[model samples]
Structure formats: structure tokens, C-alpha cells
Target: GYSYSNTVPGPIGSILGPAKDPKANATLPFACSLCGSCTDVCPVKIDLHHQLLTWRKEIRVKGFLPVSKRISMKMMSWLMQAPRMYRFVGKMARSIVPYLPRFMLYNRMNDWGKQRELPIIPKQSFREWMKQNHDDK
Candidate 1:
């Protein structure tokens, strides 16, 4: 998985460069399960899993990550941190995703729906169910 790139240059060099070795790029770390075996086995006790996470951030900063992935992460971060927004977006997505045309949901833009059938949104959220059934009387 490692290679010396003195042979590669220019646009080719960018792909094979020391910093951007395509073989050693983001996908390896993304595939990792973070089992921490690397961290445990290192004689110097390096935080290997943490280092892998740091590498993901570096890859993201270097604009190696996909635009859609970056946007989705940002959207998730914003939505998850705000309770009302989370509830609203969750409800909205549940309502809209099912009704969306197959072309809209299964396009290249939606990587998730491209490979798999979209999830069926439930009729009621947990909060809504609990409100009706578990309300203080």
C-alpha cells in the first residue's frame, strides 16, 4: 500500500505525490472500524485511531472528501445541535422522501438512495407518539 513517487510528476505527481498518495488516502481510514488494535500494539503507544480520525479531518481540509458528503455532514451537525430544527427536518424529510419521484431520490446526487431503496418514513415520531399516549393526566 506504500510506494516511492520520485518517478511521478505534474498532474500525475499530484495523484502519486507523497502527501496525496492515492493508495494511502481517505478510504482506508473510512473503512477502519476503530478497533484500536493499532493503538494497543504500538510500542510507543501512539493514539492510532485518533491519528486516523485526524487524517480524515486533514483529508477533508485538503478538499479530498466529496462535496455532497461535506454538505451532508454540515447539515447533520446543524440539525442535530438544534432540537427544533432536528424535529422539523426529520418530520419534513419523512414526509417528503417517500413522495419524491424515483428520479429525484435515486439520482447520482443522492449516493445513499442510488444503491438502496429509500427508507419508509414512519407515521409518527417517538415524541409525537409519547405525547399522545404518555401525557401526564
Candidate 2:
């Protein structure tokens, strides 16, 4: 759980490089949310919740994910942040809602799925919601 980075340089401090080891990263194991979305979204239908927990143990617990995968995740975060591009994708998502599978579209595997309904995407956006509900008065 402790980060020791004397081998390479990272942002903030270098745990794997030259800075003193951080007391630790999170020590807790990934607990199962048992959300079925993983299963539903899985192209191969693997029980991803189980797989996720397993990977968490192997990776977070054992330092197992490939470096490429870690880099790709960082890349994905960057790609997701462009407002115009993200909005284009959001529009596509809304357009595709009618065709999205129950598992992926509905968040069915999520623990809260049992009690929660897939919220209707409103015709009006959140800004509209705020405008209707929030008055200077």
C-alpha cells in the first residue's frame, strides 16, 4: 500500500523514483458493488463484477495491469474532457438510447439498479431545470 518511487519521476512526489515513499495509497480491497452492468456490457458476457474484483486484487493488490492499459486510461480521461467532442458524443448517446441494451443503457448490474428506475432523459437540460426551479425571488 505504501508508494516507494525511487526508480522514476512522477508528478507531485516520486514514489517509484527519488522522492520518499508515500505512507500509502488506499489499502482497502475493491468491494463488489454487484452491479450487473459489467455482465450486461461485457461483449463476452463475463461476470465483470467478479472479474473486476479479481483484477483489483491482482492489479491493485498485486500491481498487475499492463502499462499500456494504464496509459490508455489516462488517454481516455483526456479525450472525454473536450467540451465540443464530449457534447457530440453525448448527442450520439441520446440518439442511441432507444437501441441501447438493458444492461449497459440501464445500469442494471449496479447495486442500486434494483431500486432505481432509469431516469428519463428530459427534453430540457439541467440548465433548463434550474431556470424553471430557481428564481431570484
Candidate 3:
């Protein structure tokens, strides 16, 4: 039921508005869900999602992203590339997150947790499960 017009206005305003402040418009691109719904509905077949991704890259390159977000992104990138470290962190999270106080997990710093409840942590990782269930077969 959502319309492309809803998402189009922000980017259009940022591009056409007299003030060319990247910092001011930095949040505009990220406002999108990147679901490609806008692109699907565009009459001109514009790649709105891709354009939004480009804007995000430009904003990050221009250092408009907040310091906390930048550090978190870097940390995630590092963790993702190191498989052993990633597994260790995952195990640690599974073991520690549920026991952590609400304030610790749902604070202002946890933007993802602000409006949503964390999912119940599983007893074992998917890798462990797969090994147990499939490797013997």
C-alpha cells in the first residue's frame, strides 16, 4: 500500500533545495528501507534504491555518519571477516546477552534495540546445529 512518492520527496528536496549541505541531508538516504519498492513503482524506471545506496556511501565518505555509528560499523566489519572471532563473539552473546540488564542492552547506544524486542537466543549456533544433525549422516 506504500507509494513511491512518499520516499521520492526527501531525495528530490535534498537535490533541488538551494542549500547543498551534505550534513543536513545526510539522514535522508538512510530514511529509506532499501526494499526497492520505490524503484518498482517509479514511472521512469529510476533505480531509487541504488541511488539511495550511493547517497549513503557519499555521506559516509563525507564523514556525516556519527562517530558511534562509524565505530560500530568498523567493529562489525572486523568481526564478520574473522570467522573464529565471530563465532567466539556469537557464543559470548548467547551466553551473556540474556543475563544483561535491560538498560545495558536497550540503551540509547543500541539504536536497533530501541523499538524492537530482542529475539530469544538459541542454545546453539546454526553451525553447531548443522554439525550435530547433518555431519553424522
Candidate 4:
């Protein structure tokens, strides 16, 4: 089910597909996985992933994306682009996740955790573990 979106050209070509309605195309960008596999399999070699990314940017600019998705994307972008913030958030998540109640983390706000248990943060980061282990060498 997860890979279906990427394997087929429906979501990728929603904007340019045979559909005559704009409403049908507007939501198409969200369904694509943007995995580029479609482009590879296409007879004409269209850049499916690139177009999907462009459509996503256009959708964001048009303010069509849901607020929750937009906010989460913003947070993720910031977390990845800023190493300090990433480290801080990693430490905070690790320290707080264990202490927090299941209801708080597994609630409606967290769709990712709805289906399964959340990941357990390790006691030490890779950097810390390497530092300790390599100190003797």
C-alpha cells in the first residue's frame, strides 16, 4: 500500500493526467511518494519526482496544504538545517519520551504512533558512544 503511490503514475501525473478537473489535480500532489521510480519506468522518461516536488512547492505556496502538515514540515526542515536545534530536540525527545504518558504521545496529534509503539531512544547517541569507545584507542 505504501509503495503503490510511487509505483503508479496516478499521483505523479495528476496535474497533467487525462483528468479535466482542477479539483481532482489539486489533491494529487499529496498522494505521491516522489520516489522517482515512475520516471525510470516511463517510456518517455519524464521527470516524475522532480515534477512532484515542484507541485508540492506550488501547493505550499497556494496554501492548500493542511496546517498541521505544513507546521510539521517546517519543524522538520528547521530541525534538519540547524544541527544545534537537531541535537537539542534529539536530547529533549529522548529525555522526555520515556517519562511522558502513553496518551500524550499516542494520541490523535501523533498519527505515526497510532498504529504502533513509538521508538525507544537509546541512552547514548552515536557520537557519545564513539567518543567513549575510541578514547582508549
Candidate 5:
């Protein structure tokens, strides 16, 4: 066997675990969950859940994934959970973007403002949207 440089497989399990096994691929499901969260969280808004499900259908039902990509699915599940943490990260990011050289920022994130406008920070979020709406009654 050729020497594979991937780190996903441990020294115990060789370079690649079997692709279809659930235990080996945490991201396969987490990607869908992230999709759901994104659908709810998108400010300008997009239906990420449907797209994720479609991706799943295309990948699993259609058997389109290559051997290398299947095992790397564990990355998504470990990423997002707390609202405060997410907001903190957003604030940190927003604080940083203005300082970056404009060309560097533009080059790093293509279409950085092609559609999205600079966010107008609201007094509260959509959760607060309902509360404020009800309070006006």
C-alpha cells in the first residue's frame, strides 16, 4: 500500500476507515445539523437545511464521495454550540475586518459585499423580534 499522509485515520486504524460506517464519520450528520442552524440563523436568509439534505441525498444515495473525503466528515460536529461564543466570535471578526487592508479583505473573501450590505446591528435578534412585536400590543 502507498503511504497516505492523512491524519484522520489513527496509527491504530491504518490510513482510512471504511467510508459508510457511522462511527468513522461524525461530520456526515453534523453537516446536516449545521445546515439547519444556518437556515434559522442566516440574517439575509437562505434555506440551508434543504440544501444540506439535498447534499446528503446526492452523496449517500448517489454514492458520489471519494474515499479521501468521507473520513474527514468529523470536523463539523465539533464546531458550533453556544450563542454567546458565536456572538463573541462575530464581534471579534467584525472588529478585525475594518482594520485589514481593503484589497486583502476583498481578495480573501470574494464577493464580500456583492450582495450583502454592512449589517445594521439591531437592538435585538429575531428572538427579540417576537418579544418586541408582542410588547407593542
Candidate 6:
């Protein structure tokens, strides 16, 4: 039997309900892909993705995110604010990631890459490409 209430939005919405303790359900929102599929199919025209995003913000604000994730986000924030460092890191990743062993890249520490093959790293970033192709003009 098909169960409509078992979808991503149902459980997340239930856990995020006003009477429920959102702090206890901090990890629920991150489970969504934010693809808006649930929003599209909703007969009531509920903005499910927006609700998920709001829950994510609430989780972050309440400091419920894991330490490792918080540290990584901080590091990424720092890296993005430094233009030179960002470019350097991008260059290094493009040059190095392809040659890294599969075991190293797809290990448990890399949850995003564990289940799927990573896309081929491009030789240059979009900024580099734009500079090369259009800067002369």
C-alpha cells in the first residue's frame, strides 16, 4: 500500500510543528534535498521547501548543528571571504582531486561522495574561463 504520509515533507512538517520541540528534531530539515518536489505536488499549495529552509535557519541559529559541520561551515565562510585563498584552493582541488585514490576520496569521512561518483573536476573555474575568454575583449 502506498503511504502519502511517509514522504519527506510529512515527517519534517510534523516534527517542525509548533507544539513539537524543533531543537529535538534539528536534523530533520537537512534530510531534504530542497528540490521543491513536495511543494509542487501539494494540493494546498504549501511552500514546503521554504518551510524546510526556515527550519534549517532555526537549527543553525539554535546551535544544533554538529560541531564538525559548524567548523566546516566556518572554514568555508573564511575561505570564501578571501579571494586569493578561494582561487588557490579551487586550483589545488582541480589539480589534485582527480589524481587522489578512490579509497581516499570516497571514504566514510566524505559522506557526499560515498554513494556516488564525483563529477570530473574541471581544469579551470568559471572566473578563470571568463577572464581568458572575455577579458581580452
User: Which lDDT tens digits does candidate 6 get at residues 30-62?
Assistant: 666788898899888888788878877878888
The candidate maximizing TM-score is 3
TM-score of candidate 4 against the unseen true structure: 0.63
Candidate 1's displacement at residue 31, Å, is: 5.7
In model 3, which runs have C-alpha deviations exceeding 4 angstroms? 1-21, 31-44
Residue pairs with backbone atoms closer than 3 Å in model 6 (clashes): none
For model 3, give the 10-residue run with minimal summed lDDT: 1-10
Q: Give the higher-TM-score candidate: 4 or 5.
A: 4
> How does candidate 4 score on lDDT?
0.70
> Per-residue CA lDDT of candidate 2, range 29-119, in tens?
2323556664677677665565444444555434544455457656667768886776666666666765777787556335345566667
Using lDDT as the measure, name the better of candidate 2 and candidate 4: 4
Clashes of 1: 0
Top lDDT prediction, candidate number: 3
Candidate 5 vs candidate 6: the TM-score winner is 6
User: What TM-score goes with each of the models?
Assistant: 0.60, 0.33, 0.72, 0.63, 0.32, 0.69
State the lDDT of candidate 1 residue by residue for 8-56, as single tens digits.
5222232334255633454444545567776788688767677666666
Tell me, what's the RMSD of every candidate? Answer: 8.0, 15.7, 4.6, 4.6, 13.7, 4.4
Candidate 4 ranges beyond 4 A from true positions: 1-46, 130-137
Please give the ranking of all candidate structures by lDDT, highest first, separated by commas.
3, 6, 4, 1, 2, 5
**lDDT, candidates in the order shown:** 0.66, 0.48, 0.75, 0.70, 0.47, 0.74
Error (Å) of candidate 2 at residue 117 is 3.5
Which candidate model has the greater lDDT, 3 or 5? Answer: 3
Off by over 4 Å in 1: 1-24, 27-52, 130-137
lDDT of 4 by residue, 1-137 (tens): 23322223564455463133333355566666778787889788888778777777877776777788889888899889999888788888878889988889898877668778977789877777889888776
- Candidate 6 off by > 4 Å: 1-25, 31-45
1 versus 2: better TM-score goes to: 1
